[model samples]
Target chain A: MPSNDKLFAYNLGEIVPLSEARLHISDLSVQRGYGVFDFVKVQQGIPLFLDDYLDRFYQSAQLMHLEVPLSREELKQVIADLTERNQLPEAGMKIILTGGYSEDGFTPMNPNLLISQLPLTLPSDEKVAKGIPIMTHDYVREVPEVKTINYSMGIRLLQEQKAVGAEEVLYAKNGIVSEFPRCNFFLVTHDNTVVTPAKNILKGITRKNVLLLAGRRYKTEVRDIRLEEVLQAKECFLTSTTKRVLPIVRVDDVLISDGLPGEVSLQLLQDLKDLEEAQMTSPKV
Target chain B: MPSNDKLFAYNLGEIVPLSEARLHISDLSVQRGYGVFDFVKVQQGIPLFLDDYLDRFYQSAQLMHLEVPLSREELKQVIADLTERNQLPEAGMKIILTGGYSEDGFTPMNPNLLISQLPLTLPSDEKVAKGIPIMTHDYVREVPEVKTINYSMGIRLLQEQKAVGAEEVLYAKNGIVSEFPRCNFFLVTHDNTVVTPAKNILKGITRKNVLLLAGRRYKTEVRDIRLEEVLQAKECFLTSTTKRVLPIVRVDDVLISDGLPGEVSLQLLQDLKDLEEAQMTSPKV
Candidate 1:
């Protein structure tokens, strides 16, 4: 059954019933997945990682040659207006830009946009504190760096990992670890080095912050990592806007750090928490 | 310069200015390219290949595990309502279904729908009658059968083809010829046989009809054809809802039919027209 609860959604240029926000059948973005967008968590009525997310989003759009008519400042205002209208404190915000409708009927011309606030249920306190288990799969994001709407395989990978009783999936191609479907994958080596896949992953905002914090305390390297290296890691973790710093206690039945969150993982989690708390107390921009 | 004249567009269930329809930034479809949709042509105020197009569209949604809240009948009615509202005589219709806002703050629970129509100009008479040149690229659709929004590479391929003065780009994978970015590829072999890629291509409605008619008069095979085989063909053609059956006079720089529209290509085009006329004039189902 579909959810009938009302939602405040912005379609085109007006606020409308969530049920009525529809896209045309011929939209190139919808028809061929020819669009790019960004997602930011709204914490205490403020959007986190807004600029970073938009920067990456626009980069992907530029790569695809999708004309984003709105200036960066204008888009920020649109997002701020959307969040204010929705009155969502701790929710998710989405901005979509399609290749728009074309007059020639073949190529896309105008871009389509929609913004909305989503209901969010955070992970239980116990799960968040104790961390979560994860599984590694030999799946790769087709365009690992860019956030685009072509994630059928990624979705399937997530489902498969969930079915196996894991919280997330860390994907690798040809035994070279790539990244998680919705998060960035990182590992700590025996030599006290923190490593992640160089650019074959989304340049996640949360992940970036984590990397910055880690660099201050430990030797950090951004390089290609093999499955063998991941399997031998002393600790593993995933990072995302929502996930923050989540430790992977086990991968594909193999225990990492004696099947418990490693010290390094816990340290990173605490660091991320401190960062979030600081942001929460900081003055509004 | 961008076109200043805008066409009327249906946004979220309401008719709106073509420049206004927009999607959210946090939508999983836009953020991760996790959505499905369909497109078809409207001719003489009627959507051509409506049923076939919708069927394939929903099939794509099914593959992605997206639920179309509207039933087939309900959706048809909605599309009809949309077209009537737009009052488009010959246009392009688009339908986009995105995984809606989710409670998890990461994944969505519902799907968003958007429908719109754009005033479209039909193919130029000279190009339709005389056919066009095409370029061959060794690229493969990541997921060959289902048409998803992962079209960055496809669009890039098209731009690359056009740069060399070609109208379309014929794709090949490991020496095997695939379809065009938005059309199905066909070839008339030296043995006078008509062939297309067996599967791995969009089951285009127009392509199916053309194959059926062509098979009635000639030995037609839907089997894998190598790039070498296609390059050695006597005549080549491409098919889509918009182009119908268009001859490929050249591939790269090699002449297909003395660098002109061949007899076989001309015959297939005529056959396609006859089939369309027959279907349109038939009594109501």
Candidate 2:
């Protein structure tokens, strides 16, 4: 067993070693891939945006019709317990609620919940500054607003994406740009306005915070973004739990205005870090 | 433990009790819902259409980039061993191959193979004669050709479908009829021509056999089917491993023709049974 196997996880109602966190083969998560998940970043023993993540997690479960077995306060307590047990200040907490084991493989039954905390390493300053390349695929996710455990298309395209040195795949449909596989996309227009696709996206907590920060200094527009507009944008960036605010230097082979991370994206990243620092240092409610 | 917990299943490479067959939460199937599966019907100790089912299973795994750890012959042996151990004459065998345990939770690692045999009870004669009602939903499956474990949309709509007395949901996108949640849709025109959707379908083994049998007596067309045409269809039915050639009498609020099992569908169902009987009686290939 690996050393990380010693790490603890919340399985069903019991806290067990990560290695022992197992699910039956009949689970819809295994049988029909029917489940929803949410990730929360743990910074210095603090689960960042816990309320927001929990709200989205419960909403996702509701959309998928998999009732979360725990109440809001109970779930928060579980997360708090897991955080203390794992003893990892800098980590990611993955909460999964699956359509439980069904007598027949097709029906949704009592839900099974599993929560695990794992080491999370954010992008280095140099890498974030240099930015990453992403490839666009003409596809749209189903039930885009809900963060379900359905990432087959993105995971399947990993090989093809890696072949071109792209770190992510941006989903687009009918020439309209959407979100990336795991992150939300943002564009800085030539007029310095912030634009991001409004529909068909799993609105990320980081993206929400970034939008809040960007709103303070720039005119932010949430609407459909065209691929052509993206190509002509002054800057591009993605926001996620782990990728707080990473710049995107290139989309496919086209450079995002001068083939470098733009000033606006860099400024947003710094602002996001400042916001995080404030949240981490502020007194709890 | 449940009484069925005593049943055996093949997990990874070991044959274990079904209750003991579990996967780690880190598996892509659990974390990302990345996997493919195929079901085969077994009768009288023989797996019907084993070759065709195996071919499709491998094809699904290939399309999902999940390498089936066992070769064709090895898989056949595993199925045979499972059949012998389970000692059930009438059953459904599920073959699942998943993007295995990944370190990053997004990457596809070494695949996991799970084979399990479960008791299968086909629809009663009265149920088949009366036919089942299905609701039409404005949706299309992602990667419809591959038999992936992604059935979130279908399963989530179960309650709504049941609320309207629908046994299944027929997915139609932009007025184009594709397929049912877990079966293939077919129609018989007023002129006696048999038609089934050619694109965006799983192409079930039972559908293939029924099409072959129908072709022997009727003009068969494999092409796009529209919702407008289905309402005018002389007969409507579905084909699946367990369903065989079950008729569809009522589609939403509209009934197909006289709202009774059409002669053409009943004839095809009989033909399919005849074929199955012959296969069960024939010597091993």
Candidate 3:
């Protein structure tokens, strides 16, 4: 028998079941793909780093010229209420802000917020331990920083990435590998310095946290990262909401160093976990 | 009393009501805006230039690496059936090919094709006589030729365009005004040479017909079109499926010569309408 766990969807101002949550076909979100979204992880019934997620979400909305229908505090309350209703100690919440339904398309009108929760799908321990291979694709996102619903270039090469036995696709512009489709990447120099591209990439929350934590003890530098430096580096890793400090063993179909998970990546992964655990154990927000 | 009229939505292989067509929230088309679409103008219950529309639609899908689930003949048959079922003497049909829903959102799967018909909204003679004003935005579409669901850049400037009292947004790369967001732009030189940007613009079916008709009577050149040339040209116009030929009287807060519709634009509009009338009178394809 299947479990009777009901998933909740916060559509506009109403909380409905996931199946009942639907936007009209005339909505700009569906018609012209005008929308912005952000994902936040929940732990032990507490929404984690929701403020940061909302910050990015609102930032994306501003960049896309979409107005958030609800106030920031109201949105926060909605997420908290949804988390309480769902009662999932460990899950992920995705908040979407879309351009509202309109007969005259391409004009900004009222905005609709659709919030949904899903079971977290983090990178497995084994996958993280052995590290994964990534292929390089020469393409740049239209708006590198704003997390819009435009991913045509990134996802169009999915089959090719799978064909190469690659777990992710890394994007490069003019021989500079900046970021993957959904994550931020970093490098560990031969001399033990940690480096990541400072621009032309979305500033991932996990990446920001890792940088803050690592700056306390390690030589951390956020600057321009060329493809040559990535290939010549001792080790490299990637960071995102679901996948934290995922070591990259190979890039561009070539093994990095000895084709093993780097020491810095392992240490940073543990560091991030400890930080997350502390945040989870702290008083509920 | 309300008249009973049922609007049909072709969702993949199923023909359902327009309201009944719903793609999953996790579908790549919704999540990542991975899709391509084309619009066809129907006249007197006949689907006009559907072959040309489908060719461009397929070309866009191919450019985006999206595979249409149905073959050309099958899709054509479905379109014909849908048109016949609707029985609208004059209408506009929009066909959308989306990246299917998946457990993993990025990869392209079995495509979902959606076809919807809407009452035609064409350019009026009075409005054409007092030609439209357009504003130039300094941005280029990521894929200028492909009709992908990436209109964020175009739509984000909606407010700015409205502030300037502009009807549409024309995109420019550097100083070359390539095309409008939804139409192909053209200019007629002082020497009566009709010129349009050969590349970096969607090859609209109407544009092709206009070019063919004009090339026979006038010296027509399809080449690079600069903003300076557009401002200096004797006449300016744009073409699309719904709007056959629209004369552009003003651009970038500057009034064109005499601030009125040009002779070439008027002639081309009539010529294009004659061609359409011939096509309509010809045997149904």
Candidate 4:
């Protein structure tokens, strides 16, 4: 039992203290790193784009062959319950489904569902305005579409990223650019054309919303973006649940168009904020 | 507290029941799948080639930027204590070091170490004698040299492997065969030369021992092995702690030679047994 002040989490159908939400050693998430997870942002006691996140969450689970124990409606109810119990309006909700305790530590048996809410702090306005530098590495994620718990490569490169003063890694393969480790990347060409890689990315909800919003105003294209074109782009930015249209001013040693936040990126950020505000006020049914 | 009959595991600095060894949901192993693990085979109360396994384990942790909390000698003592407490003459020992409870669920913090001894059942002699069929996929593991807990791709392909009547997956990039999901691949060429992939592999301890044993009697080469060469090989096999030298009779729909276990594979299996016997009697210090 924990104090009432402790944060609560939905753990395998039970609302328990976050500290008490533990998994046994036999779970494949711990043993084999076999699991998929999706994150949603909650604001003003409302989950933003919950349906979109849920849709991708189930798709990722299906691709990974993990069966979600609860139906979509039941999962929504659990999230609502957790949100009410935790009482954290501005928090991040993580829905994780893992290959359950295995007898041989290889096979996926009964799956385990763990939903946790934690405080999420977005980048400061000053940081977002200045943007961040990114390092490009020639690599590709395995099962790029499935949001599995496998981030070993990106995590392993943290030291190198820090050494080079780069905050994120943009993956590229065979001269074509993909997404950042945790975010979808978009670049504005010199002619103000917005482009993003269509293949080999974990189509982020924020990216989706940004694409929709940007499509209404800008000429958008989802195709293979080469590294050479990224350097030539007038503006560049990344999108994710945590980083909603955050700009990338530099790629490696090269500055992205004078190393300043581009007009298109800043506008898209405002557009995403407007969308979030509307969703928060209306409260999706 | 656990009953005396329960299996014991070394969690962090303390020894506890295996079932009681649990990690919070915030662990990177669960949150981000950021960790590395090495498996060792214990024969008659002795962990075979423990130094080799530990060397590789440390290498893996280093590559992943994970600082192992215990020194090599301390880890050896923990393994010895676990072996004594479990009283299992023949078993598999798993050493897992995960990015500990992260404050943000993304970064690696104080690593958590979990050491557990589990009952291991090797493939029956009959099964090994007849060998198994494997399906080759055009995929490569991220960080192929590190034994990280990122087997999601292989695990996801389990259903397809079963449908195709293949016991394991042989991963290849382009047309070059790297290794199996959990083993190092080897092939006896038509000219009776032993060959294995030199790059992009975990370099299994069993593979190391087999290479040394086989080199004594056969011409051996460690270089890039292509799928065409594998299909035309006189013999094909895989080596791991659990499967010392199990034969692979077929790759996808193509059978190797007569689709039967070859003589060289059988001889190497005998050689591996002899080496294990020596290791069991004369434990490395």
Candidate 5:
């Protein structure tokens, strides 16, 4: 069992044992939906793409009228300390800031800061090689800019898709393809142009990197990708902090071009892998 | 500060310090809004209407596809022990059940159970006597059947309303009266008939009791009351577990019948008080 033996969390101001990082039942973050968070992967003792992820986190907090309790530099130091305390070279770090303890059920005064890491074992080479299936759901991510704690719709939709053996749930509104509940969706049009939903989806760090890398290496276009067009795309894929560029060979029982990873998706996945490898092995800064 | 200093909470079958009753940061309850809860008031060292609250809690858990980690009897015992440990003669008790920690962030196992209490000072007679003015916001409660943690709309609307100098926010969807973000909305028509919106409102415990009490006393009517009609109602009121029955003398700057508590609202409030006073003070077996 990969347990907290190797897990250390930054609670409030200090890096502490994971067991000590607890939330009082009175916290509005728990009683009400008043918290924001971000997850970044670590490799070779370095937080991958920290700057971009932090920017998104701050954007989300601003939308919620929550001030980041710590300065960006202070937060960065804490992340570094958290990594040092956990003694991990490769893991996934989640930074959660909750509108902390409040006797007033709806009004929160204290803000909680919790940073923890978990072991990461990316999918086997074969799983990524064959690509994965996705199911569509009709649910809009509220405060999509901020990684808010209230993710009931996303979680339930994911569970329903997983129950039917799908890898993800592609959420849509008004028959237009939004993005996966947790990942960003992209498609390669027949004209060899790569397409993705507009910024309405989570401005995922990995999604941004994938787009930049793909544009640098191949022809691409980011726009309002409709569901009907997505169903007929030459290739479909998803991007996330953890799953960098995963191919979506099937969307709901519809075979995405003979149920195989599209040529463009495979190339983009390789490009993202190359980018990650360069960053992970980049000289210490 | 009115703290429940003696309040003990049950954390995984062990009685722990009230302050130490905590859940892991990754608990789905906090990570995702995949948790359900119940809040009930304790009066004179006894949990008031606990059975009814617990029944609703279980129903909420089931609706969220979560299993209450304890048997009904076990939960009751935990509640009893929790109340005893807290030594709270009168306080607010809440039970939170989250589909516990998970690696995949989707599938959860070993749901976490948290119980805590805090001294709640009910509004003074002076405040209730003056009644509360409210503003209407276009919003609707999600998963009205289950007390899920995804209450951002409810909490945010209330906060926004408060910013505008309103004590509460009444939500309406498509001109139909929904509910107050935190409480249930009720009105007394000009004909001495009590009425409230039937659908899309939390079947609040206090609302149920008030309805029953009104039916027994004033022939209350339960129907879909539109927002316009509610705003123009001769008398308006709100109900919640803690508030019991509070008069809404004003809505959106409009005085509800000369900005005074309506005759029917006043009658129902008295009826609710009598019922609360009639409840047995002794702990039930």
Candidate 6:
């Protein structure tokens, strides 16, 4: 699908064309792959869980030593203005913080921030219902706790995942499943416990919300979920801003829950949607 | 000081302006930090050790699964064309290979290759005479063998290094000195043995030449050199395409041999200069 032609996007405090929102070639984001970013879902022109996202965004920036060019209130105001100017009821707001260009190519001088909103491409009902298949690979991310723009291993494994008829690849190191390429991996144990890796993975906002929802309804264990447990899991799912509690029906051609989406995964997804619905019905921020 | 104004740079097989050399936002190099690059020094319009640099560039590309869009011969011709067009007698050539933009913004589709030539800024005489001071940081890059663009940790420590009046940071993990942020580090032991890390480095082209020079004249050991050994070494230095064999008279607060450039490191620098002189005086490619 083609991207929506927006009249303006938040580019270094000024609204510019989405097509023309470009950074210098010397920025660390382009030169050294040093950057941090966060995504939030905007519904009915209201950004859902803005505080959670901005908090995590700040954490990510601090981890990478990228100073956000704007203060918290200023950043929020920029996002609100972008949401208003774009006039999109539903979209994905991506906030990127990069170490700005330096005189010497390798040094960090200043920080640059850019905000862009992309029209949401809702997942197809058929694919959502059938769930997505993912392949597993033995890999792990550096500084796995931060939402940095270093996805080299994940992108390299794209072809191998496609060849296996999978949509994503789950990363496992030493038989311990850590994360999916770009999302948080969760598994429902045979005893009806929700387990996800607590280390060497990004603490995704969606994963946090799902954990909160799961805690009230079922037993939740946040620890290292090994590949062996994943293989024997009654159900599997991934969580991200774009994919909230997406079901995983198969792994490495092994049918998960008889190749069906489990009830718990669907229920948690409904929980997130309910939260989003409440925010959408409320007044805009 | 400033980049040379080249009429065209090789951009995905098409020649484009140096200022217009831009990649799509969805390219993995920008979005995912999945890319590899190598730099070759050109003096007097001569590309020094072009073959060795390209071989390492291809190795780095293969390690990251980034396919170069052009063959070695084609790439050489493009670099030659870029050099001639730029008309820079002394410069640096940066070859970049990236997984191209994806339709879904998460997978590799096509590959993009670009060659850029930048005007060389000669280092100050004071910096050369006094040598450079560096601080040791306990961090290691992912896939340290490949020259990928993931320098998140190094960039994060730029401020600390600057605060200490250091030119760079030497990466050490568990007291084992592996490499500098962008160069291979070497130390001259008390017994006059040349030592460098055998693993977790890019195997610099300059390092290769210096190693050859040291092997013929001194006792050389290509193995893990600890930080303690570095503090106690008679002298220390770094090797890279741009910096060549630069002496390190001080690391953090500890001064090497009373903060004087040792004879071994100076000799190695002279050896690299001699090799470059030979290359430049030879027939231009």
lDDT of each: 0.74, 0.92, 0.83, 0.91, 0.78, 0.82
Give the Å error, residue B93, model 6. Answer: 1.9
> Where is model 6 chain A poorest over a 10-residue stretch in terms of lDDT?
A1-10
Best by DockQ: 2
Each model's TM-score? 0.79, 0.99, 0.93, 0.97, 0.92, 0.90
- i-RMS values of the candidates, in order? 5.9, 2.0, 5.0, 4.2, 2.7, 2.9
Candidate 2 CA-lDDT value: 0.92
Worst 10 residues of 1 chain A by lDDT: A1-10
Q: Which ten residues in a row have the lowest lDDT in candidate 5 chain A?
A: A1-10
Residue runs of model 3 more than 4 Å from their true location after superposition: A1-5, A283-285, B1-6, B283-285
lDDT of 2 at B120: 90
- Per-residue accuracy of model 5 over A89-108 as CA lDDT, tens digit each: 67888887777776666776
- Tens digits of per-residue lDDT, candidate 6, B33-58, equal 77888989988778999989989999
Give residue B26's error in model 4 in angstroms: 0.4
Estimate the overall C-alpha local distance difference test score of candidate 3. 0.83
Q: Encode model 3's per-residue lDDT on A47-136: one tens digit a residue.
A: 777778889999999988888988899998998898988987678888888787666655657887888887777888999889999998
Indicate which candidate wins on lDDT.
2
Among the numbered candidates, top TM-score falls to 2
Show pairs that collide, candidate 2: none
- Tens-digit lDDT track of model 1 for A160-227: 66688888878887889888877898999988788888857888898899999999889999999988
As for candidate 5, its clashing pairs are: A60-A146, B6-B86, B7-B86, B8-B85, B8-B86
Backbone clash total, candidate 1: 43
CA error at residue A61 for candidate 1, angstroms: 3.1
* Candidate 6 residue-wise lDDT, A13-78, digit = tens: 688877776665556666788788888888778888889999999999987777898999999999
Q: Supply fnat for every model shown.
A: 0.30, 0.74, 0.46, 0.70, 0.49, 0.47
Score chain B of each candidate by TM-score.
0.90, 0.98, 0.95, 0.97, 0.94, 0.95
| Least well predicted 10-residue stretch by lDDT in candidate 3 chain B | B1-10
